[model samples]
Target: MSLTHLPSLHRPASHGAGVRHKAQSMLHWGLSQGLPNVVVKMAARKGDLQGLLTQAGSGDEIWEVIDQVRAQGPLVKGRVTFITADHAVVSEVLTSKAFRTGNPLDRLGFLATASIRLRPDTMHPLVEPSLLVTEPPDHTRYRKLVTRVFTMRAVEKLRDRAETVARELLDELEGRVDLVEQYCSLLPVTLISQILGIPTSERRNVLAMGSDIAASLDFGLSWPEYRDVDAGLRRFDAWQEAHIETLRKNPGDDLLSQLVHVQDEDGTLDMAELKATAGLVLAAGFETTVNLLGNGIKLLHDNPEELSKLQQDPALWPNAVEEVLRIDPPVLLTARFAPEPTTLEGQYISAGLQVVVLLAGANRDPHVFEDPTRFDVTRANARDHLSFSAGRHHCLGAALARMEGEVGLKSFFDRYPDVTLLPGAQRRPTRILRGWRTLPAQV
Candidate 1:
């Protein structure tokens, strides 16, 4: 549980010309062997996540990178030798039964595990595995305990409440407001908090702690930031543990309570499993949904023609949501490791190596959609994008997120047909998750 050995955010200084030569050599190897895409190579040398984020901010650049990699082949080595990114290859890798989540021994080592604090119970509580990190049959077992509850039917039951929460939050907006703070961000956390049965009074604490914990997924962090994150996680765990106890004594219809009371024909989840599951649900339920709403709104604003189309026909809200997701998904990247040596798109992938799938990039692959970069709400196949990911690890709350987005966006335009994006909207700097930090809007 100690954070004594946390890694620094910046990439360490290389040891003179020898290291520089080695990096150059790696870059050459990538190009010569048709390994990584050009952007990945540039990112590797810089060791700058900010630069990479900036590069991906434009859809055309992302598709260009994906196209460049596709030309080389379906699979190519990434900026890091151990990583790879290919649009077609990534799609296959995500769905293939051969690939799995988590690589036991990665370059980041303990620093990576400690950085996130996945397991908070062991001597190395930082290495704890949640649903996102576990491989089957462990993943299967853990996922099974909650899968039924996340089913479309189960989540649909919350649609009315989700809509109510969104409408009420938007109804309070006056003239100009920071949509990210006032509406998009508040709605998801408020909705998830209610679902977890966290008291209305304590939801602010939950949101703060959840934000801190969620930042752990960003990976690169300075010691001071990690210290703050570590402290926040400890507080979060303490609160969740106490809440779990309360649920045990006074179970309700909430998801957390259901998790607490769930018993299978084979057995039941242990306390550690319960906390891990609940923590993932709490964090995942809101973090991505907030981004989905913020990102979707931004996309709409950037494309006034598309926004007009939606304004003209409110029924297009559902399809518009999918297009928004396609153009700008909340989750930008996801990775999977080869549990066993396998071949993808005729390229040999070694066991334990990782393939970092650029979900947003894949969504814009030219082969999949016409005029890939255009934000067209009527695009019939927009739903096929990998925004929610695919296969065993596809987002469990996707249905709920979609419904919330549909209701939120549709209702917002209905109430304020003249809403427009204010200048100076700011985007969050985090590397893994993409969303606005301060998206100002005027009604």
Candidate 2:
């Protein structure tokens, strides 16, 4: 659609002062700009997004601001505007209800028609192929095949495997460790190998190849960088092909074999659908999890008090992880396109225009939340955050990601009681994947 609007993260999450500050900020923005698709410029003269967020909502009270945007985001219209990632329209599309979210899309477009341009100029090859880029029926059907191998029951069966990888990563953390490299990288890589039945021995090769594609997200390796992109894809496809071929010859007790057996009333899955399922699961299951783990840890370190509280009471860490997801979700934007012409907040919309939703913003809306800015883990509504997104395409691996985070964080704090950030490597700069390339951690 030519149009406007999106989903929510409305909340009233505070006691008093925080709420007032957020309310005032929301009122100011409402009066000034009246909410539209604004681009948030962070690299500013003065702390940038940090300053803006502090002004409108206490990190604890961002929810209310998020709520206001959800209730009234249609009026906004800018190719790019400035706002925190956790604002109103942003969060609404995340955490499962995004498709139904109004004002965002009303014409037959990418989201409405499910014709994801797996070849968008902005989308990387690996990224475009994932289930996130598809819509219902296809997405649901393909995901069901992969789900057969990635069930909660199966993931629970993977706890030992997960912890084993976590512990190995911890063991590698000596005097200092690139927390992202050591832990975040390990679990997902190991999980990919385990799931694909790609043999632990070949994991390093597979991961090394995928890492280039993953790094492309932060570094931008698109059509312009087709050579590097194609090279990485070629390498991965070769390895995957060899592995898949081998699995077909001698199947084992892993995801590939299980998927091979997956069938419903329609008999076995088609080749492309099966590949799509495996490909999305393997890549997303690994890449996104690593980003989530890294981002979650970096967030805790960014807020020392929160980290300290988490360390002191491990029970609080789970909620803290949820808050981290809300505060700085790994995948910040999920796209949609209108199926038909529709109007939103006085704006006329036509079919075929793509509208992207910012999950981070919805988590910080003001109307629903009292103080939508502060990062209080104990806050009752912390779990309501939309990092996993909403609607049919909600993250299928959410439960798995949560379990991994809870275990990873708890295991981490138990070992390094006095964890602190040093001069670590910088994060990859990307609007899509929100995380660091490296974050130094010292005991």
Q: Write down the lDDT of every candidate, Cα atoms only.
A: 0.71, 0.59
- The local distance difference test score of model 1 is 0.71
Backbone clashes for every candidate come to 3, 75
- Badly placed stretches (over 4 Å) of model 1 are 1-43, 46-71, 79-87, 104-128
Candidate 2 lDDT (Cα, whole model)?
Answer: 0.59
TM-score of 1: 0.82
Tens digit per residue, CA lDDT, model 1, 1-443: 34422233223566554444334333323332222235544774585332343355433345455555555554566544332344566678788888877643443455344423322232111234578877677778877876776678977887888878878987799988999888887888888888888988988788777667655664444445555655677788788889999999999888889888878764767777887888877766788888888888778767888889987888888899998888888887777777788877666777777677778777877778899888899999989888888888888778878887888777777777678888988777655677788888887
Error of 2 at 250 (Å): 1.1
Off by over 4 Å in 2: 1-75, 79-130, 215-226
Task: Estimate TM-scores for all models.
Answer: 0.82, 0.72
Which candidate achieves the best lDDT against the true structure?
1
